[model samples]
Structures are given as structure tokens and as C-alpha cells.
Target: MFNTYRLIGAAAALALSTTTLAAVSPQDAAKLGSSLTPFGAEKAGNAAGTIPAWTGGITQPPAAYKTAGQQHPDPFADDKPLFTITKANLAQYQANLTPGQIALFKSYPDTYQMPIYPSRRSGSAPQWVYDNTLKNASSAQLLDGGNGFADAYGGIPFPIPQSGVEALWNHIARYRGSYIVRRASEVAVQRNGAFSLVTSQQEALFKFYDPKGSYADLNNVMFYYLSFAKSPARLAGGAVLVHETLDQVKEPRQAWAYSAGQRRVRRAPNLAYDTPISAADGLRTADDTDMINGSPDRYDWKLLGKKEIYIPYNNYKVSAPGVKYDDLLKVGHLNPALTRNELHRVWVVEGTLKSTARHIYSKRTLFLDEDSWQAAVVDQYDGRGELWRVSLAYLKNFYELPTTWSALDVFHDLQARRYHVQNLDSEESSTVDFSQAIPDDGYFKPAALRRRGTR
Candidate 1:
């Protein structure tokens, strides 16, 4: 939890400070499309399966929630897709391609090789992908989450399956952890009334928790992603997303989505007036530039538990689209998104560590997953904790609800090395609507992020 990061790799030279940002113009390599899991997971393993964790962990009894009259349906298209991606059926499916996904769909990237914007419905790919089907949805998944938290409304035909350009850039860099619902009128009219969203193959009828347990634990709680449209290489539309920001937040903002090709959605007006980082300083680390609504912080009331042990989420379980659940947990305290959940089943904590940790591996460790708070697994140590890094996160049920899958595994054991980031894009966009009011030139300088570009 707090070994301070357990310094020892030889910690030193730490005195960070680098203001003067002002650049903005970076949306090309898919805006550097990083941080889906910007290196998470370090420990939490051991439960049979041999030191590689997360294999479904919902304890039991948690499924059977329909609610007749009030309102509730598309909790991700009524829980379906164990498989179904398109572009004219994608050759009865190709076992869900993955060699890093045929090397990014044949290296296609002219904005993901577009030649069929012919009105937005031409998407075709087969013949054995004769051309590797170009590539470019650039990633996405959070179209609608059955109203996950409330007032976050986005919906746009996502709950994806997969096609080409890695199912459109992994469905726009993973629309983000699909599944949500919580509404007491946002705590009785905006105290932040619980919310959620989903629609594209509905299914969220889960309110059991251990229902005499046999299989379905309601996908544990909900929040899941990983695509090749449900692998083995069924590589149809393709995706691997993860994104949920509010950056160490109190209110940083995210949920924007508009991309017609990086058109605009990016956030950051003052990111709630800057100043909030907890860790990460360099080494390809840019997570704390403070972008608020444009996105960068995944909610700040962290907790990361002490350590229960158990790493490697979803060890390898492909069967989403409304996941029923068999196993996939990398637990600790819990996932930790918005806040408040005092050690639920047992054990507690929320998150704290960002007076600027400057991540190049600042000795991090977290293995939460008490049902759904989320953290799963993460443990990096470089200031000298002598572990290097290792990450894992797992959660299932994409459209039907309860999702979160970090699956990040990096072990540099000093050098026998390793690398991973299967984040694929998470969700909970970060919410917004503090009430109309949108003008800081409309997103702070640099021509307002090159006239806005997060489409």
C-alpha cells in the first residue's frame, strides 16, 4: 500500500518540477494512444493456476435484476455477444486474430485506412482479410452504458463486436469499461445521483451476488473489455480499450466522444484548475499534464488496499458480450472509481499517492478487486523496490454491465524483462455537465487544442 514505493532499486535524483506546457498539437499516433494501463499490475497472485492471477472471483449470488416498470434494459444489449462482429459477417469469423492482432491490421493507418466513409455503412472485410482490412476505428466501446452513473449520456451504437482496422482502432481506443447503473436521482437531484449507460445488445439483469452459486455471478459486478471481438482470433471488428479519467480527480472530466476521425472530444479547460498529480514523472509518462474534461485522470479518491496478493487478471478467458462469469479477479481493496465503499466484503481503502510520484516506475503497488472497486493488480518498483513491474486486471460483461480488465503484465525482473498493456481502453468517461458553461476559449489555449480534437 505505501512502502513509499519501497525505494531500493537505487532511488535518487528526485526533485521534479516542469511547468510551461503550452504545446497541445499531438493527436496523430492516435494522440499517442497510451495509458490504457500505462503500466499497472505488479503483485497479487497465487490461487491454484500457478502464480498468474484473475480467473473469475465473484464469491457468489449476484445476478437477477430486471426492474419492470421504472426503467432498465440495454445494460449492454441485454447480455449477448459471446461472439458476433461484422463487415458482412467477417468470414464465419477468424478465430479472433492476435499476434498483437496481425500487426495492427496489416499496419493500416491512413486514419485507419478509410476508403469507405461512403456515408458511414460500407465496412467490409473478408476473403481472409486479403488486405488485412485496412484499420481505423481507432478504438472505442463506451457508446452507452445503460446510464451507468447518470447524466453521462453518450450512446452511439458501440457495444461493438469487431470488423477491421482492429475493429476500428479497437473501437476508438476502447470506449472504456462498459457497464453501469446507479440512480437515486443522482443522490436526489445532482448530489450526483447514481447513473449508468448501455444499449447495443442489452443485458444487465443482475442483482443476485451469489444466488446459490454455480456459474453466473453477474460477471462479478460489471465492467469489461478486450477485443478481436472475443478472441481465439475471431478478429472481426477488433478492440482492446481502456480509459476512465478524472485524473486523481475531484472533478476533472472525460466522457466526450465524438470522433469522426479525431474530430474533437478532448478535455481540459483548467482541469478543475490544475494541481493534483499523485505519481509518474517521466519515461514516456505524460499522464499528468492536467487535461480535465479532455481526459487524463481516472478519478482521484484512490485507495489501492494494502495487499492481499493475487495478480494476472483474466488469466485468459474470452467470452464477453454480457459475460456470465466463471472467474476473473485480481483483488485487493477494490476498484475505486468515484468513492465511498468502506471495505465492503472486508478490507478497505480508496486511493492516495500523487503529490506527484513521477512514474518511471515509482514503486507502486495495488491489488484491489473486492467485487468491483476495480484496481485488480499493479506493482511497479524502480526507485529500487527490485521487482521492476507486473500488472493484471480482469472483469467481464461488456454490454451487459460490470467491466474492468487491466491484464497488464510487465516483469523486467531486473532484465529478464517483460512488457504489457492490454488495457484496450476503459470507460466511465468522467462525466461532465456542471451546467452548460463551456468557454475558456472553450478548452484552454493552443487554439483550443488545435480547435478541439478528440472526436
Candidate 2:
């Protein structure tokens, strides 16, 4: 028995030691301001002048913009498309396009088109965030075989990533605003171009970005999120509260659901992985909420280096309050007229499911914006190695917070000929409120959910 116990302890030690080596060298970390941006993006542009060098990103809101809830005016509203990519001209720009993007033209030759705009490196975070990222570069380490992170706080955890999992960790730990309240609508568009809106009110407090928070105070949690369905009588009053943890392997994500019909709040452990999102009408999985979420333990990740691609960027026009939902939603895809695609460098990472793992997607390829570490595009494949779904995030600079994040996330189902769009606030009375105060710790407790739900 003593010998068996010794063997088990040794195995555990080996696993921990393996993940501790995921840190980059201090010499590479020192390049943040010299050869790399503070967030670790290449400071210099490509040899061609098409993509310009990164000056400091747009840090201030436009003079016309008053407060957080108002619609943000596009800084580059006057700029027109440099060129358009259609089925006729796609081959000319095929080198910079993803396979899924190329397939879109083939699937909808007449309706789908990409308007290529001049690249804008408009993503930026607060000065404190930049400082934290520099610190995290040499300190953060992957824990539990890429399931979590350690020795990091208040920044992109792996700015100078040495592994694909580290790149993913950077996305998972990217800086969003400290706290925000949002009113948005979601739709699962049918093949026939018909859809019903599912409106929701959501709140999030990113403890990782809390000005006063430290690694010790996080309690292994990254953020606190609560979402409530506000429209459609059947789903109204239903709410979900989640405590997203930093070290999920040690303390798994704590989630609770309040059912209006049942008038009760219950533990919701199945909110991760391949579980279908209820509000999405079975169009997206829970893990697909933020393009990539939950644990990275189920797959082997490979870093494919960086490449220039036409990705959705500076998409303020699409999220403008004046643009009604009707004009944005088309039969096959979002109205090309409202979308903006730009040429930018993105880090590519691929994940293949492990033999011991279980997931609907057998493999996934992720393209992360170098400026913001946000997953901009994702291509998911099925067990048979067939492309199943393509996900895109339309990102814009939230100038008030001085941060760049997704204004809208769209998932395209290739086989079903349908799609799901989330985070539409065009018709809402109010958009995002970033000045909201953080709630007390007790507010997110399961018991508190019952009280809030009953009300």
C-alpha cells in the first residue's frame, strides 16, 4: 500500500511539472516594447505598406459620443471599401482567405460577398492592462495540462505565448471592461430568411480586471456573469448565473439556472462543452458562447504561427443603433453592405480532440486577433473531418473602456443552411453600461439566485 501511494504521488508531481514549463524566457518577454507591442503583437507592419504600423490605438471616444449607453460613432465612417471580394474575384485574394470563407462564396455565389476595407489596428486596452500583460509574460504558467492558469492577474495571461494552449489562454484571459451591463437580442435565422428575436439583459463583472483585485482575492474565479431572458413569454424570467473560474480543474465552473415555470434555482453543471444553448434554439453549444470558453483539456493544441487574413474588424457600422435588425439579417448571411472586413495579422491555432475526449467538434481552427487576443474566426470540423460550422466575431473598440471586444458573434451551420446571431442591441432602449458597480460576493451565491428569480 505504501509503494502504491508513492507511485500515485510521483505521477501527480510529473503532471504538474510538465505544465510548469509553459512559460516563455525572460529575454523574449523583454521584447514587449522593442520588437513587440505591449500585448505582444509585432510592432512592425508587413514589408508591404497595405497594413500600416501600429500607432497607439483609438483610446478616446469621439467628441459626439456622450456616455456608455449611447451608440458609438464609427471613427472611420467616411472610409470606403478598398475592394470587394466576390466569387468572380475570390481567387485573386484566395491566399489571404480562410477555407470556410472561400466556401461561403461557393455556397451562395449570388448573395454572399466580402467588402475588403483598409486594415485598422484600432484595438487598445488601458495602460494598467498593458503593464499587467508585460508582467504576465514572464510569470504566468499553465496548470493542469492547459485546463487553467496560475501566477497571473489583470491582463492577457500569455502575451508571449510559447504554445498553442498558451495562445488560447491569452484569449480566455483577455481584458474586457471591469464591469458591464448589456441589453441585447439573439436570433436563429432559418434557411427561408425568417427569424424571431430572443431578447436578453446580461451583466458581467470581470474580477480579473478589477482595479483593486489581486491573485489572492480572485478565489480562482475570473468573472461573474448573470443573464436573464426578458422576452418571449415561455422563456421570460429564466436566468443563468455563472462563476467562471481561473483554475477550473481545481474548482470547476459554478453555474445555476432559475426556471420560471418551476420557480426554482438549481445547479447547472452541464453548462459546459457540447451542451446545446437553450436560448440559441439548439443552434450553438454552451462552449461556443464566446467563440471559445471552458476548459482546453480535451484536445492537443498546435500553434500555426501568424498570417495576414481578411477578418471582421472595426465593425462599428454593423452595431450602430440606427441600423435596424431587418436590414442586417439576410437570407444566407449578415448584409454584406453593413459588414467590414480588413486585412490584419492573426495568430492561428488548431486543436485536435484527444482519444480520451468527447466533443461534438472533432477539431477546431481558431484565428486570434494579435492586437486584442480575441478569437476572431473559428472553423469547427466533425468526426468525419467535414467542415461543420464557421463562427465569426465582429469586433469594435469600446472606446469608453479603451478595449476591443466582440460587438456581435455569428455562427453559421453549413449543413443546416441556418445561422445564430447574438448580441444585437439595435432596438434596445439602452446598450452597454460599463460604469456599473461590481456586485458583492453574496449576490452571485446560489441562494441569492432563488431570491432574484422568485421576484
Name the TM-score of candidate 1: 0.22
lDDT of 2 by residue, 125-204 (tens): 89999998888888888887777888889998888776778888888889888888998999999999899998888988
Candidate 1: tens digits of C-alpha lDDT, residues 1-455: 11122221211112112211111122421222131111112223334322333233232213443331112122222222233223334333323221221222232222111111001000111211111111111222221111111111111111111211111112212223222222110000111112111111111111111113211332222222111122222221222222232122333332222232434444333322223211111111223121011222221222322323222223212222232111211111111121111111101122223446333444343443332334433444455544443333333322122233322221112222222222221221211111122222123233333342321
Q: What is the TM-score of each predicted model, taking all chains together?
A: 0.22, 0.95
> Per-residue lDDT for 141 in model 2?
83
- Cα deviation in Å at residue 163, candidate 2? 0.3
Worst 10 residues of 1 by lDDT: 113-122
Error of 1 at 159 (Å): 17
Most lDDT-accurate candidate:
2
Q: Compared to the true structure, candidate 2 yields what TM-score?
A: 0.95
The 10-residue segment with the lowest total lDDT in model 2? 1-10
Candidate 2 residue runs with Cα over 4 Å from true position:
1-17
